[model samples]
Each structure stands twice: as structure tokens, then as C-alpha cells.
Target: MNRTDLTAVVADATGLTTHQAAEAVAATLAGIARGMAEEGSVALPGFGTFERRARAARTGRNPQTGEPIEIAASVAPAFKPAAALRRQVAAGRPAEN
Candidate 1:
């Protein structure tokens, strides 16, 4: 779901107003972004980890013209789900601890 839907869920779950929940969600996302930018990673127990990963420069083909092109190296954000989350998704429900 999108931000609004997520905000609604947060509000319902936490007994907060929609506006408060929205702010909370925005702040949480901003914190995660800042953490990734400054420290290169953030880990949340029982949820997942967000990290910056390096991508090496590589050659690629232009789709439109089939011409060769150089792709510059860059750092990209990535996520790896915790084992609990992975198991929950695999089981199609919350997994028993």
C-alpha cells in the first residue's frame, strides 16, 4: 500500500490521528534515508536491514539503438529481509517463533 494507506494503518493501530500518523511515517522514512546516507546501513531487528551496495562500472547496450554504452559505478540502496520476515512471507502468514 501507499503512504496514505500505511498512515491509516498506523493511525488505527496506534490510536493516533491521521495527521499524526502521517508525520510519524514521514519522519521514520526520513530517518531511514538519513541513516543510509550517513552510515551506509540501518538494521532493525525482526524486520530487515537497509544498506548501500556498490555497483561496478559495466558495459550495457542501449535498448533503442542496440549501441554499446558504459555504465558508471555507483552506490545503490538495498534491503535484505530478516529471517523472520522471510519466513512469514514464505508461509503466507506470521510464522511461529
Candidate 2:
């Protein structure tokens, strides 16, 4: 679901107004981003971990021309689900710690 749907769910669950829930969602997203930027990762127990993945500079092929080219180093964001989350998804049932 999108942000609006998530906001609605949060609002209903927490008895918060729509605007408050929306702000909370936005703030949570911002915090995640900030954490990623500053620390390169964030971990939530029973949920998952978000991290940075790095690729080194290297030579790569130009697919169309079959020519070799340089590929710049890069850092990318990634996520790995916790075992609990994976189990929950796989079994379609609540995950037990």
C-alpha cells in the first residue's frame, strides 16, 4: 500500500487524526533516510535491516557496441528482511520470536 493507505491504518490503530498520522508517517520516513545517510544503515528488531551496498569501479562492456568501458564506483541502498519477517511472509502466519 501507498503512504495514504498506511497513514489511514496508523490513524485507525492509534486513534490519531489523519493529519497527525500523515505527519508521523512522513517523519518516520525522514528519520529512516537520515539514518541511512549518516550511519549507512538502520536495523529494526523483528523487522529488517537497511544498509548500503557498494560497487567498486571496474571495466564493463558496452552491450550494443561490444566495447569495454569504465564503470564508476557507487554506493546503493539495500534492505534485508529479518528472519521473522521472512518466515511470516513465507508461511502467511505470524512470526514467533
- For 10-94, candidate 2 gives per-residue lDDT tens digits of 8998999999999999999898888998999999988999888899999999999999999999998899999889989999885
Off by over 4 Å in 1: 94-97
- Model 1 residue 48 distance off true place after TM-score fit, in angstroms: 0.5
For model 1, state the Cα shift of residue 41 in Å.
0.3
lDDT of 2: 0.92
Q: List the residue pairs that clash in candidate 1.
A: none
Which parts of model 2 are misplaced by more than 4 Å?
94-97
Question: Which pairs of residues collide in model 2?
Answer: none
Worst 10 residues of 1 by lDDT: 88-97
| RMSD in Å for model 2 | 2.2
Q: Cα lDDT of model 1 overall?
A: 0.95
